[model samples]
Target: MPGTALIVIDMLNTYDHKDAEALVTSVRKALPGIRTLIGRARASDSPVIYVNDNFGQWRSHHGELLQAALAGHHRDLVEPIVPDEDSLFIVKARHSIFFETPLAYLLGQLGIERLVLCGQVTEQCVLYSALDAHIRHFEVIVPPDGLAHIDPALADAALQMMQRNMAATVCATDDITLDATPPVAEPDAAAG
Candidate 1:
């Protein structure tokens, strides 16, 4: 069976943006859930992949980006979920993790057919990534508590959309099962 991967999205933020105030509040609430999911993934030996926004540093690598965030004022947020040696990092400049990135190819290489996504910006990155994953025929799981958002209402709407339109599983962190066999991807009729 193809493996399941736990994707951590845009969690290494510096919190300097204009929308940081509301986002930080949501992120703080999401931290424990995201952290718990990460620990669970590690314990199960599932791949833990972190996909972060580029923050407009086109040349920056993962380590450099991580250090920059760690040096920023909001180190407390970035410190707890720091990627471990076993974790893989992917850099994304856009809202969708698959947009102009190697993530799709990486997942193919890893034989990752099911993705459990956790992290920030529910109304934006997380939402877009779920659509992209769905279209690519991967089973997508989004744990609401593991997500942060700039606007709670929009985030809730986004989650609903993802659940209904994209057929993503909306569940809690404790309910995730990384080792269970993923359902085979159904052929997309619209693609024909």
Candidate 2:
């Protein structure tokens, strides 16, 4: 049967950017919600895929990224949600998870038809990733409370666009359900 995958985007951050402080603050608030979603996804046998930024390092891998992020200032946020041994990790150089990455192909191989998007920068990476997922014919679901954003207004606008333009289901973390069943056909394909 088709399944749902929880895509955790850019949570393994070094917090070394200009808006790092603001992002960290927002991420701190969203940590618990993200953690809950991760736990639920694991319990439901849904795949937990960490799609993280490579921080401009072309040779960098998941182990290095995890170590750097955990050693950096945001250890509190990164430690609680570290990927397990069975989890999948993909490093991306761009904002979208599917941008020049094998994420779409991997999802296809795993038989994932729906994505539960969580993690940092709701306005940027998360939004772009959701759009790509929608265009690829995958169901998109974003948990607002489980996402971190540098700006509140922009984040809200991004979420609205994901809902209205991409037909993504913008839900709260508590309401999301990851199961083994495939997604039902959306009422309107144009929306997603």
Candidate 3:
């Protein structure tokens, strides 16, 4: 059983969005780190879970998402981090990966207590999902270099908030270690 799972959020993109160009540049910069982390997670025998946006493809599954991304103009950005045969995938429709998704239940089912989150739009989906994971009592780790963002400033602020407010470890990909025992939550200062 894997104690920690690497959650790659919203990376199987078509590169056809309103802010695609800026995002593409960041994705290119972040690609190597993402690849390295994915490879490390696989080598550790931990679960590599790709939780992606459905892209309004209401009838499509993970296979369709992977195919569409591979066929897109930015195949360079999508190919390296594509899910493998042992990878688990879940398609989400909202900003948070847990929104209307079976991810929470799945995490419980898999006995995943800690999550290492990476991928695109650090200010949006990653931030929201970090909050959700925090509230659900799952330890969250964010590797800044492994993430892509449209705005670097917002991304930095989001990382800060995740660390300060959510108790997430805003770390580098090289610093990430999937340990079995998640850090115990601090007692509420106001309660005592």
User: Could you tell me every candidate's TM-score relative to the true structure?
Assistant: 0.91, 0.92, 0.91
Candidate 2 C-alpha lDDT tens digits along 1-192: 358999999999889899999998999899999999999988987899999999888888899999999989878888999999878999998999999999988887777999999998999999999999999999999999999999999999999999999999999999998886454454686877
Highest TM-score, which number? 2
Model 3 clashing residue pairs (backbone): none
How well is each residue in 59-172 modelled by candidate 1, as lDDT tens digits? 999998999889876898999999999899999988998999999998877778999999989999999999999999999999999999999999999999999999999999
Off by over 4 Å in 3: 179-192
Flag regions of model 1 displaced more than 4 Å: 180-192
Error of 1 at 128 (Å): 0.3
Q: CA shift at 132, candidate 1, in angstroms?
A: 0.3
The models' CA-based lDDT, in order, is: 0.91, 0.91, 0.90
The superposed Cα distance between candidate 1 and the true structure at residue 157, in angstroms, equals: 0.3
